[model samples]
Target: MEEQRVNELKDPSASKKDELLKRRKKQVGGAQGDSSGTASQGEISPEEAAEQAAVMRSQIHLFWGNMLFERSQIECKLGLHDWKKNLDVAVERFKLAGASEADISTVLKNHCSNEEAAAGHEKKVEDPISNVVDKGDN
Candidate 1:
């Protein structure tokens, strides 16, 4: 499965790439140095090129993936903030757009059910000072 393959992927770290580079260098053994692990000489073997290309591609993929993850996370947070800030305006606009009250209520109930449930299930805050005072009195 695609998810399984994704789960198998190791975190992109400098050490893993460094290890690959070290191995490539050992394989090259006195050849023209290529930091990307490709041989700098005129005649590059296809296998060597493919190997180096895969490494470079993976590094690039991880870099972009991290950037995307951070950007998307921030975007989602901002969206949630805007949603909470403008919910009343949004609902009023929906009414002005000729949406039925029943439909609006249904949508709001579904969207805000999580908050209602969370509020209902909130635990009572314990007072440590009260407990300590009671203990001293006892």
Candidate 2:
């Protein structure tokens, strides 16, 4: 059995298999090596990093707000008859529009309960001056 094992170890196919495994290891290790190379490179300045972060935050906020507005519009058109399904559709649309899962949840949590509520909120957002004037003693 020992002699048979030694013979198998010397087989050309076995050597080829070993070569393939080593090549795979190198490919896997190369990915880590590239990341380390990037780490060794210079980092971004603090101000630049802060600016980038601010821009990203603004973009996310804008995306969330737009999704909310769109959701409200959809609710207004579809009415309150299958609200759960409508909210699901709105969430899916938000995902397709590049909203993160957290943003989707936040939007849902802050969403209006029915079409009437959605219309009221939409009107308030779309016409703040009108809302104030209407509330005033004309």
Candidate 3:
């Protein structure tokens, strides 16, 4: 329901949110959640795994990313600087959503890494400061 609302309003600027929305189009389940655990329990297919991964990544992104979730009912919003705390809550949600243990494991990597951000500021082609003309001198 929350995701659907997020999807409907659709803040199209953020790259992370864009990716998350794209994944939502392909999300599994009957509008419920994710896939369940193991072959015995119910093995998650590749597509389901991808969708579940996206959900985890999306939740983590929303929590730690630049976006403010003041009205968001997402569980991760309460998780501040605590990736484990966020992951724990997300895991339980996914479990209830029917995500398998292996599926959860696949998305359990450190989602808080800054690798998504650029390594350094992109240098402008020409330094604008250097091009400043001294009109008074002229």
- Model 3 scores what on Cα lDDT? 0.44
Q: RMSD of each candidate?
A: 15.2, 23.5, 14.8
Q: Worst ten-residue run, lDDT, model 2?
A: 7-16
* 22-129 per-residue lDDT for model 1 (tens digits): 766665675645556555545556876776676666566544543443444444455654444344554554444334566556445545424556565553234666
Q: What is the lDDT of residue 133 in candidate 1?
A: 82
For model 3, residues 1-138, the per-residue Cα lDDT tens digits are: 677534432321244446645655544333344344322324456875776576566555434422222212233444446544545665565454444465445444323332233232233423454455544356
Question: If ranked by lDDT, best first, what sequence of candidates would result?
Answer: 2, 1, 3
* lDDT of the structure predicted as candidate 1: 0.52
lDDT for each of the candidates?
0.52, 0.55, 0.44
Would you list the clashing residue pairs of candidate 3? 35-98, 35-99, 36-98, 36-100, 37-100
Estimate, for each residue in 1-138, the C-alpha lDDT of model 2 and write its tens digit.
Answer: 777544432231344345545655665566557855653223544764665565455445445545555656566565756556656665654555445566556566566555467788888787987778888956
| TM per prediction | 0.38, 0.30, 0.25
Candidate 2: RMSD to truth: 23.5
